[model samples]
Target: MNKLKVAVIGCGAISRLRHIPEYAANPNVEIVAFCDPNIERAKQYAETYKGRAYSDYETMLKQEHPDAVSVCTPNSLHARTAIAVAEAGAHVLVEKPIASTEAEALAMIDAARAKGVYLMVAQNQRMMPEHVRAKELVDSGRLGKVLTFRTSFGYSGPENWSVEGNGTWFYSKDKAIMGVTADLGVHKADLIRWLLNDEVSEVASFVGTIHKGGTDLDDNAICILRMKGGAMGSLAASWTYYGEADNSTVLYCENGVMKVGTHPEDQIILEMRDGTVERYRADDIATNAGQQSSGIIDAFIDSILTQTPPPIPGEEGLRSLKVVLAAFESQTSGKIVRMT
Candidate 1:
């Protein structure tokens, strides 16, 4: 097996918890470089991960020329950073929301296409065991066509989980773009599209910033999705859950209702209209700050090794981002926004 040299830009919490550890665990990967604007943070991560540390990603890329790099940066930097990594002849796996804007996401995808380098979005929910099972059920005609669905993903906020412990860039408008909508909502958007195997046709939303402090951007959003194939769904994202995070989804189909991530133990439960009950079990979804293996790193490394396209490519990320962006647009226009 040819090992791919891997570098990580932005040695923040996500890098610490997910990217570095997962790559380190993969036998097909070599941890090469760690970069962060904060020199101390970079050095500390490098010390622990056995990678060279640098404050500048460009310098690291120029010297190492790693075969694969993960961009765990702020939403605003994803496009430019991933584009640069691709242009430098390396495959990139970017943290999600893809970018702050649709155009930027498209540019990143175009650059990768032009360079013949693989680009994947870190939409890890698709890798959740129960969700994967749900897809199988959907495709098996067990669900008999989903008619409606609802999903929610929420947590306290990013203040405590960040590498800085607080004052993370997530609160800033310039860096975060739209707070919880980008942070938590995008994941659900991707998950829904993957489960239904359809794009959203239109979206209407009411976005708010009710509970978070030190932020001007929205921290909560409720969006209604009309799927291209005649399914109706709703999604809610919030940083004001107050209690433990709520990360759950339920799909209503012709034959039954699919409940996922709802209970503590039952990862997947099916309830048929004929008063039949079925339960499917799998591992829980990984939290961004958790140490559990995301299954993304191994999957991503496998893609680069076999010269196969990533499981969640840049275009797929763009689709999810467009839904979130359209929600923001809907809030401003006070009308359902058509996803063009």
Candidate 2:
């Protein structure tokens, strides 16, 4: 396979944890450059990846001419950075929530289409083993027509998780855009849309900054979703969970109820109408289909080589971003926001 040279456009935590390691593991991709406004951070990442470092993304794109680039910057910067890199003649893989607003997301999509380059949003939860299995169970008619879903994602603030503490862009409203909803809620919303193969039709939400000493952004949020299939769902995201990572989803269907969590070994517990219970463990039973850790990077490389569409196309990302924006609008207006 001919390897595709790529540049990483942010030296943040997501880039450090997922993007860099995934790229490093993929043999069909080479990390050619690292870019960030913080020269020190770029230099550090470049040293680790053994690639050129640049504080300016435009200069790096001009010089490297990479096949693709990952936009892992602040939420507010996602759309602009993606457009810049995609217009520079490179495919783009942007991190989640897509953009700070609906207009920006649409602009990014248009830029990618105009440039004739593939643009994928890195909604990596779609690639999770448990998530894929959940989709299969729902699609195979085993769920017997889904009824509703309740999902949540929460953790203590990013102070500990981030290299520079939570004082970074994640807590800043100007930089992060919104807080818990944009940071964590987008993942759950994307999963809901993907697993159910439906778009949200309306939303009523409430967002708050309940915690002190944090940035001026929502620390917690709750939203009610009215899906296209006439299913009603609720989702919550918080940075004040106080203990352990809480990433879980529960789906209630006509035939049974299914629960998925990041813990307990990525298992799916099913409780049927007959009072019989079954647990599906991808780790133990199924050879871990889609278990590849670097699936996104590999898929990006293949898209470049084959001229195929990306796994999570830019348009899909905009749809998810619309959910986020609608929720925010609902929170401010105290009304149901139509998501047509």
The model with the greatest TM-score is 1
- What are the per-model C-alpha RMSD values against the true structure? 1.1, 3.1
Per-model TM values vs. the true structure: 0.98, 0.94
lDDT of 2 at 217: 88
What local distance difference test score does each model get? 0.90, 0.84
TM-score of 2: 0.94
Which candidate has the top score in lDDT?
1
Distance from true location, Cα of 253 in model 1, Å: 1.0
- Clashing residue pairs in candidate 1, if any? none
Task: Give the distance in Å from residue 315's predicted Cα in candidate 2 to where it truly belongs.
Answer: 1.0
Instruction: Give per-residue lDDT, candidate 1, residue 168.
Output: 85
